[model samples]
Target: MSIAIKGGNIFQNSRPFFDEKMKFPSLEELTIINLRGIAELWHLANVEDEFPAFPNSENPGDSDALFNNKVALPAIKHIKMSLVDGLQKIWGSHLDVRSFNELESLDIKFVEKATKAFSLDAIQRIRNLKELNLQQFQLTGQFIERVGFYNDEVENSVLLPQLRNLKLDSFPQLKRIPWRELTLQNLRCLQISEIHDLTYLFPASICKRLVNLEALRVYDCHKMKEIVREELGDANTVEVKVVFPHLNFLRLSNLPAFQSLGSDNVILEFPSIKEVDFDKFQNPILWDLLQKLKPVKELQLGRCESLFELHDLKGRSSTMLPRLRNLTLSYMDNLQRIPWMIFPIKNLRYLKISYIHGLKFLFTASMCSEGFAQLEEIHIQDCKDIEQMLAQESIEDTSNNAAPITVVLPRVKIIKLYYLRSLRSFSSENYEALEFPSLEEVEIKEYDKEYFDLNTVIKKRCTTRLCYAR
Candidate 1:
């Protein structure tokens, strides 16, 4: 039921790969990769005899007269083609609308010569399709326009009504998505990457209809300025409320030109979001969005130049991210210190920091008593100015004499420190009070042996592995 052809001159001309008499009623999946010398997959010699209603057909009824005739690959459900240099068309003009009605998934990549995936008449009949992934195409917008929705006097018809997932990547010629003309109500997941010309992802008209979207990821888009463009009336006074009720996962990375989610006139809200990832973003608008996301549990931030500090806590008793559990920070060029007052240290379990050039220390001595009590793992790397893991500082005390503070990490199991050029000791004062009751493994790399001894730093009685990379 499945056929894959790769790296060969299997066919020599524009002839049909399957003869007219050879019927593949059970062929469900077909894949062609790196094939040469083939212009058309199915070529009918007499076009008018097989499809009398094909020339001016726009809707299904115009071709209904030829539906009774036998069609090729009637029950095919999946098709994928890649690196087919000479493939100009997948379905010949002679085929009627009912040829590949059962198709559920189509994946086409790096086939530059192919102008269109499906004919206008053929696309209207693929009502059962669920997934479509296209990448590295020249005329991507033209192909999408041909398969777009059609408006009839009686009703508005969608081209792919059953589609659930759509991904478009490396579309060099696509400047914008024609959301005003197309309707994908059932779409759940959309991932786009390497689209350099796209200005915005969605318009206000289509945001209301995407009620079922669960995951949306857009990365490596150089010219994308906004996730959604604002819509204004003739008087420029109307405001739009855009909400993604079911969306839970969002990732935006390597988008240097992105400024805001939408203009000031548009209000955007994501009530159900739980996880977010942002990388290489240099705008303060990202912080504004984070202030609105109070329910996030897992957050990853890397190379954000605008984030000099976490939102100024302003002496608030409660933390901003009360539900946060997992956090990762990397390449934060200007972050000099971690504001422990604004972090939910009691709930944090996993922490990783790397390439923070300006960070002097991670925690102050006064913060060690209650901070990171539930933390399980710690990883620190490439921090050149970190003089100590925990800075020595005095806590406010009523009596003149106070006992030495003991730092207890009751749940920590693993610790890794790499390439810390200025690290002098585990703690600024001494390494005696630190206790890792659940200690498992400790790894240190590229450190100066003259500064401190590893054996003196880790004295836990539990089994542990100490690895040093020179």
Candidate 2:
């Protein structure tokens, strides 16, 4: 039932205090609509020119007490004051709001001129304050360099220990995260967005301090090259615990200079980490880190063009993922082939390979290779040289019993093939013959269809549906 008015005007006029007081005594709400687009107002100037002192009054008129004169509203739970500037000196020094204690929320908007120093004396006075949002405010750490603004410059580093959510945006000048002084025992979510000059916030050693932090996002910070950099390169020696153990989702994107996940110098272990998404890392280092970290169900590596070979099992390379269920490798221009020799996993259910312009083979295994029994779904798209899933070779009857024609499909159910311009044929009989008994469906998607007669072949040989789409 309450309404608000905007763009209205209220002129500066002096009046006897007793005249209008009795007229509007019983009025519940009074809105002094200011239509004037005046930007600057001072307490002394308003008191001297607008409202002069009473003829024989002994007490001086209080400019800061002006907000107290508004009509009282017992039902008012929220108040929004806009277009008010230079409020730093007004509330920072002498505002008294003990009577408005019942008010739970206050929103101050478009006050860009307010100094960051003003909050030191003002915020602590609001005893019942639960939530606060500072938008487009010119706040800086140097603003409260002394006098324990929040407490000490050390005390100034105060976190709403009770606060559960916080959002800070477009603050390019914010240089440091006061993690040392701020107490965030109950903080659950934090977002820092669009800050370009933020070179560093939390030191590598302090990532363990945010114990209760569940979700954190640091996005579009162009200047920050790494999260925990010093301990990440190939040569450091430190013990870095997986900071944010309770974190379930983490996104590090568009950071062009991001090199590796962690410093090789440190023994970094992510015991509780389940998801990681990173782009533009050297292949050797990327795989090395993957070998060191714990098993995650899903992993995505993008735009690492330098990765020519998946695993150099020829030397000290690691084994295949035992816990991976879905793996996607895309846009790896130099990847010549996937070295399945090092893979120790026979449990992979779904695998997708795409846009590896140079990728030649899915594995070095012959079609009759029994080592790949657990593979169920294979999706190959946009690969330039790979024309087929497996080569066909007829097996001669060598068993003791009479020849039994049977396809063994213990797991595979779906297969997809697409966009191999150079793919003249899928699995020609020239190579070793292969057999799949569990495969039930095959989908071929591409711009050219005549070169691949997958539908006719699947219907006659595999006895499965071969869906072709251009």
Top-scoring candidate (lDDT): 1
Best by TM-score: 1
Question: Where's the lowest-lDDT run of ten residues in candidate 2?
Answer: 18-27
lDDT of 2 by residue, 237-314 (tens): 655554556655445555544445554443454555555554566666567656754455555666777655655554
lDDT tens per residue, model 1, 223-280: 9988887755335667888998888888989987888877666778888888888888
- State how far residue 191 of model 1 sits from its true place (Å): 0.9
TM-score for each of the candidates: 0.80, 0.60
Q: Candidate 2, residue 230: CA error in Å?
A: 8.5
114 Cα displacement, candidate 2 (Å): 10
* RMSD (Å) per prediction: 6.1, 9.6
In model 1, state the lDDT of residue 207. 95
Total residue pair clashes for candidate 2:
17
